[model samples]
Target chain A: MRKQLPPEMLARDSRFVRTSIMDQILDPRNRKISERTIGPAKLAPGRPASADRARNLMHGIFTGEIQALEGAGRTAFDFDETEAPFALKLDMARQCWDEARHVEISIKLGEWMGTEIGEFTEATFLYEAACAPDPVLRLCGVNRALEGLAIDVFNTMKEFGDVSGDPVLEFCEDWMLADEVTHVKMGSDWLRRLTADDPERRERALDFQRTVDKLFSLGGFRGETEENPIHLARKMREMAGFSTTEIDEIAELSELARAEGQAAVEAAGSA
Target chain B: MSDPFKPRPAFAPWDRRELPGLFDVEESARRVGAYKWIETRLFEALGGWIATVPELDVKMILGRHCYHHAWHAELFDKRLPELREMNTDRLCAPANDAMEEFVEALREPDAPELTIEKLVGVFRVLIPRKIAAYTFHLNGTSRVTDAPTERSLEFILQDEWNDWREGEMLLQSLIDTPEELERAIRRQHELEAIVVRAGGITGLGTIGATTEVEGAGV
Candidate 1:
């Protein structure tokens, strides 16, 4: 038996063609369509049935968890026992357990919402964050950024469950949401712990987090505005120990990304 | 020669109240500790298979299994304080060297035949043992003192059975040669012998033999 390195994964899947973040950002079809034109209520319903949307989101949740499990799993394995302490690896291992449960829960939730696995296309943006070579950066990218996105998505779905008066969705989302908060905090704690003596290394990791946070904003998929589908979970982020200024900066980055997306779309139209 | 369905003497009494006593604190800690290791190892094994396995369907199954183990670990960890076992730190450590050795094997860089080896070890040996252990403990423990643990075990045992069946299907489908199957079975037994010798789940030996509860009803 010989040791094999972790295999490289392409973001595209054969069953599902990925709609790149850039493509999703500058979607020409959505160009020239204003929030006012569609009206807030009408924007909620698209050609895809609510069932389809739910299914798509559930699939995304399902895939996200798998990547999360992989990320945590890799953290547990890829590092030497000395590079990252045994306890940190154990923490990652423990998180793998949480994430594994989340994956199953999401699968059940998908079934509950009438969605099947692979019913919708998956984008691998989440997994990309986990691929960072440096564990500190990976922690910042995955635990903080990716899991932070999970908090927002889960909270939004939880609200959707509450508004729709579906106890199951509300209950499941709430349970998973609590776990996401812990995940983000774990990342935060690790980032500090791993780089406590070396402030420069800590700054580099924090910078990586900012970059991911901006990318995740993805031209306003998330923001404070009503036009955004998933709102920034300020209170929840605070509970996870994110400062108010940090939350505000994320909101600003989202707005900036949205503007940049609009410019790119307009430029393409002119071309 | 005894029929499992045959009614037992009423005097033997299906005592639900004395179930908790069947597993003392040390016994409870040992089981929980092993569960934590199992969950952790399963997580790593799934990752190995997912990374190396060419078949997408197999990867998907491993993905789901990965999370199920995670949930089982959490459930076991959570059960600690309830059993009046405050030092959950004990739960994190391996109960014996066999568990430690098994995890070390899992953590080593993937072998070319790693995916098959993992499937064989988990489905053929580890999961079956887990099912047996849970079923044994389920029967021995009192429902009155620990309904939650019983329910948890029931849920986990059901998953373990499903996973084992699914794994068997994959193994049968993927391994073409009888030689491969023979090697897989042998590989699992070798590892199984270590864990059993190093004080298997409850120091009771493998459940497949010692606590072979007929019609246990997962």
Candidate 2:
């Protein structure tokens, strides 16, 4: 009989546990001196009122997203046991923790911005749509669709922060962007594992993509252009194993969204 | 630019005992089972697709992925004993029948090329999500002082990121056809939905929950 390898052995060999981006970001030297200070001092009192309000609103939205993830993280941890490839399970657990930490970071940022997390009245709808009863659908919606959107958002925020010379926001965006990629990868990995055997699963996946595209477009999560957001989405989907045809469909959907937006404006002008 | 050349710090120790306030062992078990079932089924499907591909490089990469899946299965299977020891009921739920059927369909001798393309699509969509998951964990555990589990996750996140990058490179290099690429993306979207749904059913929502703020009192 073949001797079964211990979970410890498998855990030991796991690449997910050793080289986290968090470790890179939290270097003692990288630790900001300002993090130690709290409250109004963190924000310049003389900053323009409008600028402060905008920052506060952004911070509020960020905090709300974090609160939303608290429940989401718990859900992910609970599913850790069902995740196969012991490495993947470990990865999933890591993801749960990562999301939880994101919430913390966001909350801290919110404090700095002089705002608290707002209640998300539409939270249940987002969760219900993303968290279906089927594992495949769940992965597709949350991991591929929602998390994929996150990558785009973070990347944009990172670029915006860097260009605008905001160290604090840049730091947060950089950290979040790196983690967002990994989250999407986990979803891709499992999706590949789950549907590897079914020829028809591809069609099923396409259907899900269409639904996600529609949902995101309608929800205003995705932009109506084929620029950075669409490109990033395409890159993410490709990494997760999207076929060219499906990508074209996504592109078309994006174009449709743009067209619809234009038409709506035209109709409004006529009215 | 603020300190672009900051020196990298020594790796931090990861603490496993710092369980989140809402840790649910039973839910974790269910998730593990679900992950295993999905992974095994995907492996079976991809293995079939690899068989049909005439290209040597494609076959080689697919084979490596297959080995990874096998390793993943072995690791998950080991968890069964641990779950049993913990007296976690509902640990023995049967594998997903729909996933099994999907695998069986792929196993058919003359499966169409579109089917293989779909398999590729699934991978394209799911990998980035995994990358995001790893990075999230890495960021979350950064504040912990001395935990083995945290250290372990750091490594895992890095490797997973590497895997995500490599998978993207492979998709670009190995797949020559546009149709193949499109199918790959569509499949990816589909799998994402499935994973999210699974998490909800198994109460894996904790995966996204916030950690209670650790005051200096701890």
Candidate 3:
């Protein structure tokens, strides 16, 4: 079978709406909101809009889980034993089950937070990353970058759940967070093992991962700063087999993105 | 044949293990391999379809069933070696060209609108035959000597039944109009022919046969 199924082919019913990264970037509301906020747009418990913000973020998580399920399922189905090894495909299959559970959980969590399905727009970026032809590159883009982003997002949600005194949110987020960790670990192990012989190949995979990480950072959406909504999740990343240096590099990327976002808001304000 | 061994209750149907078995080591291994191959392809196909189906409820149902098929494949993997066979990779392939064509046909419906075709080929055609084949194997086998394979078959058969029921519900929901009913019926007929030509997922004369192959050890 041919590999690299395109993102446009992904099927969604009429209730769902699509948005692009450019749409987010060009939105005048973001620039105006950024102008008023002093640092990064941090999510906290006491803010008046925090509940809706959390609900919006939960909807995003629901969509992201669906894409993550698609990505892992594709990795399991798209590759042959010659390309991806039987053991790796089995891991991918296991990850698919995990993702499916996460999808269900995320849906319940969204309902608990008073949000409907398709309340937020979805970008097909995660599944797009899985469209890599090379299996190793797929591992890096999907397992590492996309799932690594999940670890951070889930952890952030768990903390939000904990701080907000929402037991159901806190408990479910923690459970799904654990699965995301295993998923990231699986990706990291497969990426390294598959690329051990070819440093150049490894570098290429790493570069692809960096590009995705930057892209998902979404001009400072994830970072170390107090302004960012999601943190780098350094401890969780380390548990998932990321080196200190790699984690630091992701932090640097997020910092650069945050600075760039702040500059954009200032530029728009002045203009 | 005065219904010998027939007096037991449903759960305790087999009280005597004295019979050697319906299948010896060689034929059992081959059929297990064939079952494994079919399960592997099924899980892979369902996994591929999860993202492309437009109906959210269908996607969620497929997500769960996809994992169930994957686990069924794993169960076959675990069962292979207990039959004195470590060469499962050798056995894990389509039983014949017709079987391969059957599975290939299963994955052919790619677009969102073709979800009915996809489900029809699987639940109506593939899974029912699998249930038949697996039951034939499990019931014919000696519960005394080959209980492991029998046990594996039991689990896989349960999953097949559950998955089949769920998929049927999906078909009933999606097939509202007469045209959709025709689509479902036509797709089911096409796939049934392929499986029938192949003699079932295991082989011809395997599932619905009145008698076993002439030389089986039983």
Candidate 4:
């Protein structure tokens, strides 16, 4: 391929019309749901604040997985054969297997939650991170950042499964969560090896990861605090070889993004 | 967590030693080893196809197939050591140079204009050959002593057939004209001849059912 596969053209027949992330953040409809919904701890399993909200989140997750599969698949295809070594491409190839399973699992989970594919509009932000030209950057963005976010989301959903007493949900999410951990580690290991001698390139990759981490945080979708929908899995991140410093940095970025998002909403309201 | 919901076995157990209908130990080892190589290569090749396939229906099927091949690889991977008592590294190589060439051809980074052509390559050509190869081994191997191997092949066989049927359906839908269908078939066969030369439609180096162990030289 001349370049990695381009971002997919999402189906126009999708049930829901996608809103820009900014519009999603500021939309009164979403704000109404967020305002009334209880925190993750207090929310019952099958009842995720509201059935509508639960369906929305589940559909987002379903689309995210489709993109996640594409992201990993592109990593395997988009790069020049020589640009990333065969071994690294092999790793990406293996990750595709895991991601595909996750897609199937996520689809089932969506059904269990009473959400259908295309029920919620997709945001391409996850795939945007996968578009990085450099292999190191792609690894950092897709594997580290996006898969890292998956860890948080899947863990949160797993917890919801546990509290909701939904055995299947808890069981399935746990399985998927395990794969995400390995994927993140794969990204980290490659990042280190690919840029072992070149500190500057490594720095650029790390910087790219920071930008993605910020985008993923998306005004408090993730954080260590109760306010966030998904909590950073410290133990899992450590298991995936993330240093404490990195986790702390992500937490800080989460807070910054949340504040910026809140400010944008306030400005839009005043206007 | 509660104990797993284990289902009771449905069939009677066979004797561990001298079971009827089992392949010779050497033959079992060779088949398991070949499947290991096939599955591993298939997993990677499917990955490449999943990335490039434009048709959503085809992409989704390839996505599932990728994971299915991975699971198949693991099954044979576990079975290989049991059959031969050898580490996977020693026995994990491709069935033959032809098999390796076919897999390598699948992985070329060169992007094609129409994913339909690639789809034809895999569904019409590659997977059918795999099904034939697996069917050959399944029919040839004894069902008694090599029960596990037989069962694994059976499971994989069903999936291979499903993939073949799905590909056939898609090909019928996409290649509208008789002339186009004929041309595509011709083109696919031409590409597959390379793989056929390496071995044949079965991906087996040998011509037919034989007692001689395949891939022994490799």
Best by TM-score: 3
Q: Which ten residues in a row have the lowest lDDT in candidate 3 chain A?
A: A34-43
Supply the global lDDT for candidate 3.
0.82
Supply candidate 3's per-residue lDDT for B59: 80
Measured against the true two-chain complex, the DockQ scores of the candidates, in the order shown, are 0.14, 0.02, 0.46, 0.17
lDDT per residue (tens digit) for residues B63-143 in model 4: 766666767777787887778747765566666676676666655533433555666777777777778777877766667
Candidates' C-alpha lDDT:
0.71, 0.47, 0.82, 0.72
TM-score of 1: 0.66
Candidate 2 lDDT over A1-271, as tens digits, reads: 0112111211111112223323422444322322343333112223335345436445533533432242232233223345333445344435544665565667576566565444211122334433354456666666666676666566655554666677887799778767777777777777778778875874576477567665555312355343222233456456545567756766566567645644544454445
Superior candidate under TM-score, 1 versus 3 = 3
Estimate TM-scores for all models: 0.66, 0.42, 0.91, 0.68
**DockQ winner among the candidates?**
3
Scored against the native two-chain complex, candidate 2 gets a DockQ of 0.02
Candidate 1: segments with Cα more than 4 A from true spot: A1-19, A22-27, A30-36, A41-51, B1-114, B122-218
Interface RMSD (Å) of model 3? 1.7
TM-score of 4: 0.68
Candidate 3 A-chain TM-score = 0.94
| Candidate 3 residue pairs that clash | A40-A227, B199-B203, B199-B204
DockQ of 4: 0.17
Candidate 4, overall lDDT?
0.72
